[model samples]
Target chain A: MRNLTDTELAARVAQDIPDGSYVNLGIGKPTHVSGYVPEGREVIYHAENGIIGVGPTPAEGEEDLELIDASKRYVTPAPGAAYFEHADSFAMMRGGHIDIAVLGAYQVAQNGDIANWATLDNTFPPAVGGAMDLVVGVPTILVMMRHINRDGSPKLLRECTYPLTGLGVVSRVYTDLAVLDITPAGFKLVELTAGNTLDEVQALTEAKIHT
Target chain B: MDKRLPDLASAVAPITDGSVIMIGGFGSSGIPFGLIDALLEQGARGLTVISNNAGAQETGIAKLLKEGRLAKVVCSYPRSPGSIWFERRYEAGEIELEVVPQGTLAERIRAAGAGIGGFLTPTGYGTLLAEGKETRVIDGRGYVMESPLHADFALLRAENGDKWGNLNYHATARNFNPVMACAARHSIAEVRHLSDEPIDPERVVTPGIFVHSVVEYGVRP
Candidate 1:
């Protein structure tokens, strides 16, 4: 199947999410998943600032300053939304309560290692933040990212060259070009975007693709 | 009462290997470049660096990456070239890398600084972010794992600092610096300039008491 657009990509990803699944969407494009969650599926959105039952973005002129996500972006609280102290929010992540974590990655290796956080340049610093906790805590890690860098280098690689966020954490990857599953056998092609072929993606990737 | 860059380096002599250190910034902007330079000059290796992102290659923390001085890195995103370290080390089975989500990164460090033990966040609930972790339902919604954060040293940067060590941030560059500052045991504030008196109470982003040392230098990248 050809996934034509980001919206379509989101909808496709949403299809796999079961009803009443607890999820955390990373910043940037992953934040958009809140809008695409299947209707009446009871998906609870967790903001790092301690809000759940996250509704979609609000209508114009109806913004709530008190309601915001982890990224500080304004949001609409769902019917059952609840808020708590920041401590309580982290307890949930550390306690192994969350079911799914979709994050953006700079690169994912054949072994499912994730290197989304820092680069290796000494002159440039690295920020580890909570990725270490999340990668180790979460069970099914999904990486949402572009297929390639602006310089045309592959973010999906035979091996990551950047500092890793977690070792052997990522299980699935969704990119602008294709959806792949990381296995001991390497990256298996699940689907491709419209106008992209397996060969073209393979040309850009350092790993072999099993259709 | 005041000292030059060399003196500042000497004051920081206690910083050592395996130390959990915090550096302030959002992405690559607003980092403590001069102190980082000092750390580079001092050649403190095998450090555990905590920041928003590793600096760009050859500019910020990337210098540490090149020197191979960092023992481990805890961050939200490590950008280009710096990523090569993982490839050679992890893929080749030599080094260790730990990843964290952006919001979770901010909250964990903030939690540590605030003297809180832990909290529930829905950020990484259903997918891989929840693996090998406990899950709880608060009001019928599942929230995944969350961990508390703390550090030995916090290296921060700010727009201005009062003699008392009060500080302020420039903009979105304010991301994780202030929060990380509070969570560490010792904090060093590096600023572009310092004032004779304390900054206005309302404008002070980080209180002087939380900060032990002040480095006057160029603004961080």
Candidate 2:
């Protein structure tokens, strides 16, 4: 069956964002969403490290060590970019100023509960970065991840087993196989990748997807 | 009054055992490596360090954890890319780690600098991080009451600063330096650009009042 590549999925998420929207991208996969913004549609990027209007990656050998994104990936500033300390930066988030947040998740439940931070394993330290803040603060939350884990277990579930980053915060789930919305009634199918059937995708999902 | 320090070692001289120090940085950006090294030489034990990330590879907070001087760390993310030092110490029970949500951590430090006792925030509500904290529903949404996180000393890095302690941070490296400078009792700043004349007042991101001392660390790597 056909599936969307990571970039294509990011592109899909980018399409959903309205023009002039203020969006905050998570560290890894979600960062790619900024690069795929449609032409003529402007999106202001916010990095919790105290930057608004985060721009593209700087050319190699030109990285400003002091200047970086939340991922510390060494990014350039967009036009009209501004900087501030942590307080003002987070106020833009926790004060409900940001429009949307695109995050990577390990598990998402029918109630829109998200789990991305803690693995609950003793080997790795549990780190909860700005995810909690973004989920609770931002008006809309978008989760991007693969349809299933490496072991092939469903990430779309009736209830998330991992510790939640936020309770009932996720608005949409963009996976390789399909794009689904977490509604009051449960998972609602928005669309699917070409060559993917509802039965084929539903077999891999732990919860029932309302078509 | 002039607050320039002769050396990085002297900048950290006032810090002692049980000192709560805020190291300004996120990942490698804005980390005061020279001051962290000087603190290693100063050898104050049982310290509590606060920052966004613990350390990556062998530098930054890793140096302190390696010296076994730190008793605890209050941060949002203890492990960033190449943060093995934090992992080893955490697993061995050599360090106590208090992980706050990134924005909440920032706001708490900001609250200290801004002189507010405590504030209610929507972040961390109903999550494990808010387990023991007080919560209230405001306008049908849960908010957690977080207290200010003050520090005895704050180690910071900036792009430019003057003798009066006025500072201008380089790019994203400015992360927590400004707020940490305000929150600490005695804040020390290491700058890439240092001069005798004052920086343009309008251009100064952190005013002189917040910074206690300044040192010229010179250009970038």
Candidate 3:
């Protein structure tokens, strides 16, 4: 069975974004999701670093140094864009004004606990930017990442061994191998990548995947 | 009152050793680099800093960290790209780091500025950052009790400043500057446009009362 490429997975994830929803895209894989947003759907992007209505990347020479996303990448402001300070910006998330957040995850437990910011590694400093905040208050948390670790270990787990970003926070996960929803019961299979079987995808997950 | 200062060195003169200074900016923008450089030249040792990032490379907050001027840094993200000084100091156990969730940090600072003693927030609940903090379940959601994070001084950048010290920022560069302005005992601003007239009162993002001084940067001769 063939797995979806990261780009393919991002495109697939973008298809699910509801039109007119206010969304925040985390760094890495989740950042690409907005680029693949379905045609005719209008999503107002929020950058947690203090921008609402985040737009497409600017041409190389046209970058406004003052305008950048949370990732520090240069971007144009979308029509009706607004800028605010960190306080008001995060307030949008913490107050549940932000409808959805697309984040990257290290592990997602059956109970929807996410661990992304820190691992056992202390060689590099642990930086927890807005992941916890995004998970804590954003109504829907969509994690986009690989189905398994680089070492081939499962990232969809019975329980997360890594430090928790938030408890029972993830609403759904779009992985390279499959898409799943974290229901009240547990991880439920939504769909598999093209040419992949449910059993094949289930084998990679440490959590029981209810079809 | 004319809050304008003659130079960067004078702008940072009030910041002393052991001061808890908040530097405004997220990533590479909105940093009061001129003030930070002046603080570097002014040579005040042993400070605690609050920022979105610790700093990158040898610029802005990184410069302060590299010079061994920072004793502790309260921030959300510390390891910025090219921020080798933080990596070195943290690994060497030469610095103390308090990693707060980005939203929590902002709210804490806002709490101080707004004169609210403390607030319950869901931002860091159940995470290591929330450890030992009083937590409660309110309305079926868990929240951690966090205190206001006040600083002795704030150094920030703005796109424009008027004679009255009213400030307005450029695009996303406004990040922590506005909030930090109100949270500190003294706030100094470095602006690209320091004008003789007050900014349109309606357009002022930060009122002059929050600012203690202002200095012009990127001025053309």
Interface RMSD of each: 9.3, 1.2, 2.6
Off by over 4 Å in 3: B219-221
Candidate 1 C-alpha lDDT tens digits along B123-178? 55654545787889888766766778899998877778766777776533444567
lDDT of 2 by residue, B74-101 (tens): 9999978888888999999889999999
Which residue pairs clash within candidate 2?
none
Residue A67 Cα positional deviation in candidate 2, in Å, after optimal superposition: 1.2
Worst 10 residues of 2 chain A by lDDT: A82-91
Stretches of candidate 1 exceeding 4 Å from the true structure: A1-211, B1-7, B79-82, B85-87
Real interface contacts reproduced by model 1, as a fraction: 0.19
* Deviation (Å) of B59 in candidate 2: 1.0
Task: Please report how far candidate 2 places residue B208 from its true position, in Å.
Answer: 1.4
The model with the greater DockQ, 2 or 3, is 2
Give the clash count for model 2.
0
Model 3 per-residue lDDT tens digits across residues B32-75? 88889999999998899999999888888999888899999999
Location of the lowest summed lDDT over 10 successive residues in candidate 2 chain B: B212-221
Q: Could you estimate the TM-score for every candidate?
A: 0.55, 0.97, 0.97
